[model samples]
Target: MPQSHPRPYGTLAVVGAAALGVVLAACSGGGPAPKASDLSSADRAKVSTGGTLRWALDAEPTTLNTFQADATPDTALLAEAVLPTLFTLDQHADATPDPDYLTGVEQTSQQPQTIVYHLNPKAVWSDGKPLSAADFAAQWQALNGRSSAYWTARTDGYDSISSVSQGAGPHDVKVVFAKPYAAWKGLFTPLYPAAATGTADAFNDGSRTRLAADSGPFTLSGLKDLKALDGAAVTAVRNPHWWGAPAKLDAIAFTPAAPDTRLAALRAGKLDVADLSRAVEDGTPVAQAASVPGTVLHRASAPAFLQLTLNGGSGPLADPDLRRAVAQAVDRTAIAEAVLKPLGLPVLPLGNHLVMADQHGYEDDSSALAPGADNATRHLDAAGWHLAAAPAGDAAHRAPAAAPVRTKDGRPLGLTLLIRTGSAEDVQVAKLLTDQLGRIGVPLRTVTVAGDSFFADHVAAGSFDLALFSWPAAAFPVADELPLYAKPAVQPDGSLNNGQNLSATGTDEVDQLLAKAAAALDPSEAARLTTEADTRIWQEAPSLPLFQRPQLVAVRTGVANAGAFGFTAPHFQDLGFTGH
Candidate 1:
């Protein structure tokens, strides 16, 4: 669990207003213009000499493959070096499908459901093999047939895709759907080679380590065990045969740093870039680090969501009022102010929509559920729980009903909250939440488990009452929320069912709206249906959204022109050394 950090609103507002004013003034011809050749010889010298950029990551890559499972930030960082998508998400957060490898399909009157793509003429794999439409066809088939669990969200709109075929010409691919899909453009991500689709098992056997073969700017020279060198780090060198503008850095080493050690390494000048986790940002470290000259701190609005998920089985949480009470009890502002602001980050208001504002289909119209001490008490009261003031000598406490939901029956409402004890931040968050819930008279107990065991068995097995977890933003759309909440979708196998429906919420209206939204070709109709679905989810309160965690990138002051791509932090290609 990442620690919560609140951004200083007053300071941020002043700075942001000043920056906006400068931009507005510039547009109105207020600032002086600069001439060309502003670059100094010393600066040019630094840019010409490529060197290894050391970046400290928070975690290790679980799997090298991105398509097989939801890739973590660490996994994504490594994958970007080896695998290049058909189109990149731009700085403005729009998916600009690469014209070289992907082209828009024109819908003729006769072929209303057809999409055609054109591969770049120069595009070739790291192995010098030509990438063709057949590779994409094979990848699509593999995703729909073999890795349905992982591909369901990406291919939700494409369920109507009848067939994928290669065009008559080289590097051309055509896909024909049973019906029109408004989000048809989302299918243009990186595809696997045709060779891997011989069998489902063969494709997912984890033997595709060298699938690192792509047209990306960099390729895996070798998977050097960074853990062996210094626990959980991997060094990726630039690919000589890359098709795009070659990466400026010769090699980028990704080192896994714990929350406490990340800033220390940054201050010591050993690390060129560091991801400021929530724990460090809320602490005194961010202020200390930002005070240093030549160091710049950049924060991006992430689409990620951290939520408190309830188990929907015939448990104590099976009650809707109790869930609502818990949702109201959570102090999102406190979490943001105490956790986020100190780190120089902004807190996102709580709302029904799980998708971040930057992502498509996000509806900002939904109001966040407010938090209050009285509101918590009222919700608990409505749920048939009463808070009894503590007797003389003890800490103020809520009296436990002889029976859980005492108003309904005499039973203990005690429930276990399964949390991962892997990181220090996780433990801290769980403690904070436990204390808060305790004040509201919720008899919640903390059960800390190892990471692998928790996800592998407990979460999948549906053995816990409440779980605190986070979901990373995918390039897919709102329709992805369906499988997460749909009841029949949860499989007996240990794979994730639906992300948004983590609590196994069973709502027919939500399901109908989501299904309609998926099939509708009109953006307006789809947005309406999705918004309706979000409304129902919020009302039901299966999962209580915590806050949108901020992603921090700390770079040396000498790194020039470093920029972030989409919501994901800055890429290695955007970074360059500017010091002589």
Candidate 2:
């Protein structure tokens, strides 16, 4: 999912951070490299019970439904606590059946690509209804993109399902795909109850504010059930009917606040955990938080990476040659250094758009589009964009003021870049990009929009020539990322459905390769097909990868099984306080 920040897909709350000084010291050869995940791993026996965890949220979720178009990362954060998923990702990014929700899962037939999910007999919703196949069937019908009534965010794997039915028992769900779908495990995550998805009206609006039922370790805590806190937005209490390991914390309270204000709350002991990812903009809070008693910092490469999205739907970028020129004009290495250096993380520019550098199947397919002003100028010149007349001077002694400007057919080569209003990361990237593009004789101006409306109103709406944002990396890359690069299709009603491809760029070849990759059962075959598609994406210049953003989190020392979870989904039941 494309978001303003690089939050991991399907991840719960970020745990905490290691001391800023420690991370700097490590980077400066005072210690070893950072680990994949820095959460204080501990066995269940070591975790103490009976404490409320005060978690900070970037924003209050506009909708509780993760499948809705308006749903943000905050919505997914809340859903992880109260909803059930068929599978969860481990530290290695491998999908494992969540035993609490699924007893077992087996492929029944390869002909129609049938799969049978054995649900946990003890699993039941908060309304005392047993978890059954009906929920899966209803959810599939709502999100398979077969009807116009339901508005789903993405229908990658679900759209491949031909039918979802009950097996021999009520707790068994049998899913039959019309085509072979390799990323079957990604479907029905955070499954909704049948009651919510039974109708188009309820599926769209019922979970917008509150959930009708839940089947996870925590249940949505009602306002009347507990006293209100000063700034908390929502709260979740331990589910009494949870059949698996009970929740370690008595309750989890979500308090919404800006990134810069969270550290102050943490210092005042109001917030138990706070994300410090924004420390790249200002290292002051990170250094200052290290002195706070019982505070620790942890950092890791976030699953998501920042990228420069070029809108190819219209404007000067509608020409593929100009898009390539824009891509070559970007100095990815310099941009990564500007953002990651302050956070004490290695500055390595990402090469592939489909997969992160740390993820499996990652390969540098970015060799074709090298970043340099010379390359940009060459491409622009080849596209018939010539330099405008400058003040005559000795070629060797020309002043910076006499730098060449690109023009074609009496029009100057200029573009508008859209970014979030208060995002320091976006502003910093924009500043560096402005300088980079200017050197190539192109004028790039930035338009700042409200953070809340950045994606819905601008990026997704194709209202800008360029946009800077991050996409949350999914465990199932081939299936999850297909929409981000797939070509926009004109509907029968003459409307364009771009899905999640904010760049408005794609090729039929790329789409065919992605489709083959999605259906490739062999891991090697899938990897090869995905790499081929990524290479085409680079040539098309839809987006240029910058680098993997670091997930920096600060927390009290006693917090365990939390913080900087790189790719693993946090186990809420395993999260608790340990007496220090």
Candidate 3:
């Protein structure tokens, strides 16, 4: 996954446009979401640590390895509890070096963009081994993309590094970059111990060989199964080898619950917290969780977003105007409100490509749709599309389901839309979109792709006329934009590269500009170049973000430091329950 925020469901994003007014405060619907501080806080007066807090994951992870493309959000969250990454993002979107691991991190030289990392001498792996320079060197080689033995989904930041050398101390590491990369912090995230990623066989088999606590607040506890659990629930207790402030909770368990059953589990007090996203189910979980007494839904702005990717191949959507009209015809407001409002999430769409709504250097760029069905009709008419007159007849052709679909050159506008199964929200959104487009004379036929192989098979093969999914984010936004929109490239496995899988759409201009954005030394310059590239993306209308998808969570009233976390990973060491 290489830090990709994988979700079982989809989300929406907001963007700003001049004519349509693309500001965050105005365009994003719904009330303001909760602050990270709010959920992470306990009644300092009533706070007492040391109790088991049961949490719910959207799905069980296949492997404990978070670097694999097959890894899910559950695994990523679990990794945060065990892995000791060198850095973590603060609410301000600034990368802060974790004093628990690295005492210092800075770029010492600009000629080659040399960055130095100073590890704390007191910090030791759970196995009691010193966190040394060898660990850093091995991780760099395994992930540098130069080795074919390791199966890594992404190699953005690592690809820019020219060399890694030992620093003044045994615990110090100096890295030299081939080019200046502003998002350098992303390289060490979800970092694995050197013992795990040292060699080809070790990188593949070593990661899974051990799972007990090695260097985090909570260790495997050997209390039960750790990384070994998949179908069964995962459990972890306070690490006996911990050398820092002790973890608030004695043990934590990530119990798996189907989206439909999560609300019941929360109501039953079977779980203290659960990730109940609208993209997972319709709106029942939100309303149900709300009705439950002692439960509060916490939402924060997330980088993930729900979007409609129009096929650029031989389809009616190949026409940019048609794509723009589709954007207009499908009501974003209706979609967001219907699906997110009940969950108490913002309906505002994130319009920018380089950053999330709450993140710094982010602004709305999505308002270009011209804002309604009237504009949609205008665009369609311009593209030689004619709407069939209202069907006037008996029940066979009535107001419901029966309508005069669109026709162009005497051919009816008919298309098949692929929606992944298992997401109640996806099905609902698909139905709503079908109805909305139907009113506009666009006849949509919906189909369900197997959830397991949806992206690997259907999307990569371009076996779709229309598709809906979430565009997840990593610690760095620009790192993902290139693959998402760059020209399509096939991998050695014969599978479509995930980034180019969206209708196999790409352009040399987009690729070059994205590369420029990645290498830009000036922060303002990087933002400027990426924004310029976004303008072209808007014009092409390849895929437009609907809203800034809500990162929603329902937790027990007294629990603290556990809720809907955005760009930053959850700090399990600080989580606790406030009670006697």
Candidate 4:
């Protein structure tokens, strides 16, 4: 599974930051080196080692616990450095065994969907517990969502497991699935040493400030409790017990800077890596960094897409025809062009709801069934939402001025568009939508909230007619995508099972195809079924996917082996300093 699920933190949030004054590559004193991307093998051989990397977390990672939804995007950085996963996706987005933790994985049974995992004999936790089947069993039980006391954020793969038991040896774990799962390779990933997950309290809140155990290439190096001062930050140093290729970097400092201040911090030598994905615009500090002494920029396709999930369960969007009309009236190309095209990226609207445009098994559902603005007006008129002369207002309010913002039956066609504030891209996109939808007699009022809280405040609650946000693609797309497009189910916490199922419009046919694709062992059948899933989702027009969100970063030249990871964990062991 080549899924990269970025949480509310634009995929990887900044956990914390204390601005320390420093310069760029010129200040760090590194000689000429490779490009900004991950180094080639030949190039890697010539690289130097042993230095610290200050990575900017886009937002403070709310929870270090990978089991919870609040974990920040950069949690992966800490997770990969500490906990070990059984398997990791490769550059090709295919599952590859992580030699440090897993020796082998085999499908043991077909009918009951049994799978066997062989743990590395030498793998041991920082607590001295041998990597055994017990850790897997504990993870399966705690994350299956069977216990009301367990506060797991995602139970996608775990929910399908029927049992997890030890085999001939304690290190051998056998998993029996009640239902077949396609991305089974992603299970028990970022395995917290059993010491951390043995109890519900520990599983939920135990790792709040610091991890209980470590087995990966790096261990906690400094203070866990972050303070206002630079010296008190939590840092990671090479783990002594790590059995794999020894980690090259001496240490990695987890720091945070306010999103707006990251580029400035990077320029002044306070930060080593700033996720300058959005900071590349003309006037931003990142844009000016090109002229600076030492700066390296890396760009790659993010495993995510931007979407407008329409809410059809209540309010003005409840009407199917109105929803369809809104879908048609939205100019997705303009949205992409305004933001992505300037960066030499694609402006094509992503038609597939599950896989990205660049991934396999994607189908162009938008151009096939989605209608245009003229057809949108026709459909609305046919549905009795007749356009009338505009209300008196200035050119700024010309949309409402040009047409009546309601149905003929006094059903007022006004709708609300909720978006995260501080995102220049989203604001520009929302404005484009407001202007475009308003032109078609559908008046949209835009509401902005903080980025970190946007999902909880509006998306999870299904509180708005329309919303704009991006979905960070999971590492296992088929196994993890169901919760996103499935029929809406409200949980005990009032949060939704599928927050993006805002319209509550997923069909039984779509669900069936999703399951079929998940279980289809045959590669061809899985692809076909996934394509069918895309087509079925296209028919409903519940959400409009705009484009693949791009991943871009500005890194310090002193660092090597730093760039976007497509569908796998970053191999921190290989990242080191080439500094003076």
Q: Which order, best to worst by lDDT?
A: 2, 3, 4, 1
Best-matching candidate per TM-score: 3
Tens-digit lDDT track of model 3 for 1-580? 1123223333211110001001112122244432322255654445577888898866666556666555566766777788786777765355678888888987899888898999888877777888877777887888779988887655657777898888988888899999877677766766677877888776665565355335788876463433456556677788877777778888998788876788778888899988776524654655555666788877776656677778875577767778778877877768877876765565655566555666555655565446578888888888989987765667665645368777889888887888877767778889888998887788899989876667657665567778887767544556545666777667898754545437556667877887787777666677777677776676666776766666767888889877877667777778888764
Clashing pairs in 2: 15-563, 16-553, 16-563, 17-297, 17-298, 17-553, 17-554, 18-297, 18-298, 19-297
Candidate 4 off by > 4 Å: 1-42, 59-62, 221-231, 278-286, 289-292, 390-406, 410-412, 451-453, 489-500
Which tens-of-lDDT digit does each residue in 487-506 have in candidate 2? 88889999877766777778
Winning candidate number (lDDT): 2
Per-residue lDDT for 437 in model 1? 74
| Model 3 accuracy (lDDT, Cα) | 0.69
The better-scoring model by TM-score among 1 and 4 is 4
Candidate 4 lDDT, 140-236, residue by residue in tens: 8888889978877667578889998997787788999897776677778778766677788888777666677778888873435432234334578
In model 2, the Cα lDDT at residue 534 comes to 83
Q: Which residue window of length 10 is worst by lDDT in model 2?
A: 17-26
TM-score of candidate 3 relative to the true fold: 0.87
Whole-model lDDT, candidate 4?
0.68
**On residues 1-580, what C-alpha lDDT tens digit does candidate 1 reach at each position?**
1101111111110000000000000111122211101111123335644887787766665445444443345655666566646655543234556654555444442245676777776777776877776776666666554454332213434355677887767777778877655456555354555664435654565323444355566666566332344364677788788766667778877877765676778777878776554544335455665554556666655445566778775477777777767767766556645655665555554454434455544554333344565786787787777654433433355554332222345554567888766545456667777777766667678898876566556766667888876654434445445566675355678543544345766677877876776666555666667667777777666776666555555667676545223343344454567654
Weakest lDDT window of 10 consecutive positions for candidate 1 = 14-23
* Model 3 regions lying over 4 Å from their true place: 1-40, 43-46, 221-230, 278-280, 283-285, 368-372, 388-391, 395-402, 489-499
Each prediction's number of clashing residue pairs: 20, 10, 27, 22
